[model samples]
Target: MTRKTLILIAAGGSALLMLGALGFQYIGQMPPCKLCYWQRYPHIAAIAIGLVALWLPGRLLPGAGALAALTTAGIGFYHTGVERKWWLGPESCSSQPITGLSTDDLLSQIMTAPVVRCDEPPFVLLGLSMASWNVVASMLLALIWLQALRKS
Candidate 1:
């Protein structure tokens, strides 16, 4: 396929993934955690790049789209590690120590704590979490972007 077509496909892929995520969150009643939310930003950026790539006459935008895809893929892997307890995650998203807190303080903490967590995957398929799937999809999108670059 031509580079233009590849870029369009890659961008569409990102958009579809983002839409699915939103569907899971809003329609399926699954709230996204901090890390899950982090994974969306790059896709949004990539979509923008794709839209601009259609009008632009160079490879810069498509290259940026590739970088965006890889960035999300990297975040997905990090989120997968956090889900599997392979390593510690950010303090804000992970459970924190509740030691030495008075009853009222503890109550307040629980009430104000985030409903979602980055340390666990809310949905999984065939033993792979959403983040893992995102990694796979984003990597594929990245490759498409790379192929577009090569063609140009």
Candidate 2:
């Protein structure tokens, strides 16, 4: 296939994945955590790069798309690590110590806490959490982007 065609396919795949995520969040009522939301940005960037690659006459688009894919993959990997307790995630969304808080402070915290957290994995498939799957999928998208780059 042509470079443009390949980039289009990669972009379409990313778009579909994004739509599926939104569907799960809205229709399925599976709200995304902080880390989960972070993983979507790179796909958005890749889609934009794909649009540019489709119309622009430059070889750099594919490289930019590849970078975007890799960026998401990195975030996914970090999120998976956070979910698995390999490391701490964002302090704002992850668990925090509240052992010594007053009653009023505790109540305030309960009212202000996020509905979903970056340290928790709410969905899993075949022993892999959504973050893990994102890592794999984003890596695949990166490969597709790289292939487009090679073709260019």
Candidate 3:
């Protein structure tokens, strides 16, 4: 396939994912956790890379896009691990028991706790969460980037 086609596929795929995320947030009443938000940055970067790749005549942008995809995919894997309780997430988002807190302190902790957490996925499909789907999609986008680089 042509470089232009590859760019469209990669960028369009990222755009679609972003839209889906937004839809889940607004329409489906699903709020993303800290890690979920973290996974989006690389896809945004990849979209920018795709736009730059369209005008540039080199492999750098595609390589960067591949890196971006891999970054998100890695984050997704980490998120999956957190969701599955394989590892601890961030301290701020992770809930810890108040061992020696007074009533006032316990109340404050409860008041300040986040409604959404990285350890629990709001939705799952076919035994795969959104993070897992992102891993799969991002890897596919990475493959498209590699193919674009090969064509170049």
Candidate 4:
């Protein structure tokens, strides 16, 4: 395939993923956790890189796109681990010890705690959570970006 085609596929994949995430948030009434938001930044960067790569004549932007995809994929893997209890997530969006806190402090903490916890998978499909899906998809997009780099 042409470099342009590969770029489009890579960038368009990120766009679709972002749209699905938004749909889950607004339409499905599922709020994103801290890690969920972290996974999105790289996709946004990849989309911008792809758009610029189309007009520019160099491998730099394509390489950046690949990096962006891989970054998001890594974040997705981390998020999956968090959801599976394999590792701890951020304290702000995950459970913490309630020990050694005054009653008022505990109550305040409870009130300020995030509604969406990173450790809990809001939705699962085919035994995999959304983070897992993001990892799969982002890796594929990264491959497309690499192909575009080669073509460039």
Best by lDDT: 4
Q: What are the lDDT figures for the candidates, one per model? A: 0.92, 0.87, 0.90, 0.93
> Candidate 4: TM-score?
0.87
**CA shift of 115, model 1, Å:** 2.2
Clashes per candidate, residues 3 or more apart or on different chains? 0, 0, 0, 0
Q: Residue 71 in candidate 3 has what lDDT?
A: 96
> For model 2, what is the error of residue 107's alpha carbon versus the real structure, in angstroms, after optimal superposition?
7.2
Q: Which digits, one per residue and each the tens of the lDDT, describe model 1 over residues 1-152?
A: 99889999999999999999999999998888878989999999999999999878787888999999999999999999999999988887745567999999999999986678788788899999999999999999999999988887
TM-score pick, better of 1 and 2: 1
- Cand. 1 TM to true fold: 0.87
Off by over 4 Å in 2: 94-114
Question: Per-residue error at 106 for model 4, in Å?
Answer: 14
- Model 3: lDDT of residue 81: 92
RMSD of each: 4.4, 4.7, 4.7, 4.5
Clashing pairs in 2: none
Give the Cα error of residue 83 in candidate 3, in Å. 0.4
After TM-score superposition, what is the CA distance of residue 107 in candidate 4 from its true location, in Å? 8.0
Candidate 3 lDDT, tens digit per residue, 105-146? 899988986688888899999999999999999999999988
Worst ten in a row by lDDT for model 3:
89-98
| lDDT per residue as tens, model 2, 62-105 | 99999998998999999999999999988776355779899999
Kindly report the root-mean-square deviation of model 2 from the true structure over all alpha carbons. Answer: 4.7
